[model samples]
Target: MELILLCHAATRAMKTGHFPTGDEPPERDARAQLASLHALPDTRVIASPARVARETAAWIADTFEIVPAFDDIDYGRWRGHSIRETGEREPEHVAAWLADPDARSHGGESVAMLAARVAEGFASIDRLDAGRCIVVTHAIVVKVALAHALRLPLASIYGMNFAPLSSTVLERASPADTWTALNFAPYE
Candidate 1:
């Protein structure tokens, strides 16, 4: 019942800051990133449909499989807006949203919504294994999953650094099936 979550490799889309917003794991140094994660032995993987995720998962070669349920939080209309544009166009709204991701974005999913979806996705994986199963997904999605496990506030997602190519291990022991956040944002 142990689940390992890994954020997708960094992508130019992340740097462009206005191309990918939904569940898409933007393309980046994934081919290289895969090498680091794949080195670990005996890992079961669940991946999102994002291009970058799919590409990265390819290298693992049957190690981690695709589970659409593991896709990222949907950003809705604000999907591809750059941070600068968002801040400039809606300063106060942006600030408040940052303070509380639960606040809905321009026609988009809220933090609570994100948390709910991520939980459902995680629950779907509960039966996949008795040990660790690595999950490859987007940053926001990973954080939401982490938040659900730790019972953390959504506003706190900002302070948490979810850099690309990072790893977090979430464990759910058998019987009781309680999930615990073992470690977060491991820079590896």
Candidate 2:
């Protein structure tokens, strides 16, 4: 089975440096990126249960099938706060959150939790029914998925950053299967 993980289109919140709450509009560059991804051949299309993710998937598929399991990490009390503001107001929490993969200092989901959720979401997809699927979700979701696919520690999520509309393709024949390729580029 092939899984194409596409981070949601760039949101105005991303460009403006604010935590996204699924209400931001897609930026110009993100629209172009979505158009580029849409040209790929048809496959099963799934999206996280977020407005931004659903809108992004709609760019590539006729129907927007919502996958609640693939939803973005809960930001908790930090939702809608700018990074700078969060850091300034809660420096120690921010520090711990960034340094500890299991830390939920921000009162949100930990990196470990995000990785587990994304892995569970992928595992829930039936390879026999749909061998190939396109999953549109947030950058954090993409990062967590990548860490799971690559068998990296949850902290590795911090070492990687995904751009809007970036795609990471992973494939396996079964639930117990190992990755066949790391960073797959379909167009190339």
RMSD of each: 2.7, 2.5
Question: Residue by residue across 73-158, what tens digits does model 2's lDDT show?
Answer: 88878888898899999999989988887889878899888877887787777543676788888888887888787788888888
> Residue 11 error for model 1, in Å?
1.3
Clash pairs, model 2 backbone: none
What's the lDDT for residue 23 in model 1?
48
- Model 2 scores what on Cα lDDT? 0.77
Q: Put down candidate 1 lDDT per residue, 105-139, tens digits, no spaces.
A: 56677777777778788677765554657777888
TM-scores of the models, in the given order?
Answer: 0.83, 0.88
Runs in model 2 deviating more than 4 A are 29-32, 39-42, 182-188
Worst 10 residues of 1 by lDDT: 21-30
Residue pairs of candidate 1 with colliding backbone atoms: 1-130, 11-27, 45-64
